[model samples]
Target: MTKDGVDTSGSGQQSGKPALHSVYSVNNILHKVQILDGVKVTYSSWVKLFILYAKGYKVSYHIDGTKPPAGTDPAYAKLCEIDAHVLQWIYGSISDDLLIRILETDSTTYEAWCRLENQFLNNKEARAVALEHEFTYLSLSKYESLDDYCQKLKDITTQLNDIGSTVNDQRLVLQLVRRLPVDYDTVGAYM
Candidate 1:
């Protein structure tokens, strides 16, 4: 996982400090990492983990999606689209777990999930949940400092953890945040 001279931490930090929070973000990269049982992963279990994070944090959903009922109900459609993309990402990373979770969901929801899955199978970039414009707005250009980014990340992470989200790999997100070029200080991966 360590790239050439990538520092792993990607920056410097006080040694021997235990992590207070598991998830991290900078410019809303959405690494969706989770750390459990000492195993760290990024881009893995992203779908369910994202869903868990959203529900756990009470994050609002957007309506007006691309389908029937959802297409008609903008708010519900937006939520469905968001959920579907997240589910598709998670399914790609961990198909078995996603399938199991889908099987456990209501048949209607599962069917919706399949449609989302097909969309992803057809095109990867087409399902990108995080948009470039949105990312640019959140990044350092407007935010102005790493502190701002970390603070926002902390708020989001707090919400996700407090609500018992499904994230299974926290270290990945942490590492990605620390690697962010927003500042000179490098953050180490969780020990």
Candidate 2:
């Protein structure tokens, strides 16, 4: 041990462990997380996954704009470095088209996050209308299996709810029952 009792390990960390606020690299984000293709992603799901991802790196504050270090703070530079990594993750996790739309030179991570949220959530009325129509017309026969159809319905309902169009359980059940094929009429009657 050194004279002051600090670990003298060659690893450069106090106890050969990363500091609590270490600048994390973007490479650590998992590959299974889908790229945010505006059309394909149901925004809320992507946001949840991305938040969990950033939190894993102890950088969730960048996503939510909380507890940011001021310029005078000792950790400010480190936060900026980590924010750059967070920004890279955001830029890399989106489609080329979405990247083109949302990219801004010298933009902070919080700015990009808010812009992305606005992109998905701004046109609530239009999205809600379209989703409502889709939910009304969806049929089990259109999908390869009943599971796919139900999942689609659930996704539609979730998107609608995200946009402030609340779809209650009863309404969802009604839609599910109403769209059954003619062959399931007997079963539908029982439902």
lDDT of each candidate versus the true structure: 0.40, 0.81
User: What is residue 33's positional error in candidate 2, in angstroms?
Assistant: 2.6
Model 2: lDDT of residue 6? 68
Residue 11 in model 2: shift from native, Å? 16
> Best lDDT goes to which candidate?
2
The estimated TM-scores of all candidates read: 0.22, 0.81
**Model 2: runs farther than 4 Å from truth?**
1-32, 38-40
Error of 2 at 153 (Å): 0.9
Clashes of each: 12, 0
What would you estimate as the lDDT of candidate 1?
0.40
Query: What ranges in model 1 sit over 4 Å off?
Result: 1-30, 34-52, 55-71, 93-191
List, residue by residue over 37-102, the lDDT tens digit for candidate 1: 101232223445655664543331311133435356755655554455443433444445435544
Instruction: Locate the minimum summed-lDDT window of 10 residues in model 1.
Output: 35-44
For candidate 2, lDDT tens digit of each residue in 147-182? 888888888988888888999998997888799999
C-alpha lDDT of candidate 2 relative to the true structure: 0.81
